[model samples]
Target: MTPHYTESSLRQPRTPHIRMPPFTGKEGWETWRAQFEAIANRYGWDEEERLNQPRLEGAAAQFVFSQLSPMC
Candidate 1:
């Protein structure tokens, strides 16, 4: 005999999870371009701003490095 299964029991609710950027093809480039401006604005990381700023070294460099480090 086959085991019984209800529709509600068969369907599990999906939990939301963070996803990485699909950085490969045309779709990826479009996604990046769309998101990049917002991200850059949020972090004040525009190209001109970066170019105008003094090059950081020593402790300043370390601080910037730490800021850019990925969290586990």
Candidate 2:
């Protein structure tokens, strides 16, 4: 017999648990960009994750949010 899909069962995130280090603007942009691109390439991040997963935190994250609209 076939099975039915429930809301709870359908609620799994496709992204993995791996998290990039939070960007605090202390690191050089070139070095940070390289690492970010590398991880995204390795993990096959889609557009949404690419925009949202820069790992910005604290004031840096707030600054970004204030500067731009939320995507996720």
Candidate 3:
């Protein structure tokens, strides 16, 4: 007998489609953080997934990278 495959059974996880708005600092940090959290919730990301970090761009990214670079 041959195996059966349904549409959903053949589907991959939805993680590939996640496209978060990068943190550009044009909006305030609070706003961006809220969006980030919302995205996490939408994707049902746990603490580990949250720690993976969303897209951080521009001056904010630069500052954070600089601060953390010492530990790298």
Candidate 4:
């Protein structure tokens, strides 16, 4: 006889729907990073290192954020 599966074990994890929020011009990276840091803090994430990481400079940040946000 087959064993019955419990609801918790049978359920699949939900995928989050990532939204691409608006970036604020040239200062957008700073703004985005600040907002992201705030959210990370709220969730008890490691905000310090994340914000301090060496990121791609200037327009590269914009390009990367746009590409990654949709997949988040």
In Å, residue 15's CA in model 1 sits off its true spot by 29
Best by lDDT: 2
TM-score of each prediction: 0.30, 0.61, 0.64, 0.32
What root-mean-square deviation over C-alphas does model 4 reach?
9.1
lDDT of 1 by residue, 38-64 (tens): 554555555764333333455545666
Q: What ranking emerges by lDDT with the best candidate at the front?
A: 2, 3, 4, 1
Instruction: Using lDDT as the measure, name the better of candidate 1 and candidate 3.
Output: 3
Model 1: residue 3 alpha-carbon error in angstroms = 70
lDDT value for candidate 2?
0.80
- In model 2, the worst 10-residue window by lDDT is 11-20
TM-score, prediction 4: 0.32
Clashing pairs in 2: none
- lDDT tens digits by residue: candidate 2, 1-72: 899999987965566787878887777768888998998888888887788777777767778889888765
RMSD of model 2 against the true structure: 3.7
- Cα error, candidate 2, residue 29 (Å): 1.0
- Residue 28 error for model 4, in Å? 1.2
Best by TM-score: 3
How does candidate 1 score on lDDT? Answer: 0.50
Off by over 4 Å in 3: 1-16, 69-72
Q: Considering only N, C-alpha and C atoms within 3 Å, which residue pairs clash in candidate 3?
A: none
Q: For residue 27, what is the lDDT in candidate 3?
A: 74
The models' CA-based lDDT, in order, is 0.50, 0.80, 0.78, 0.55
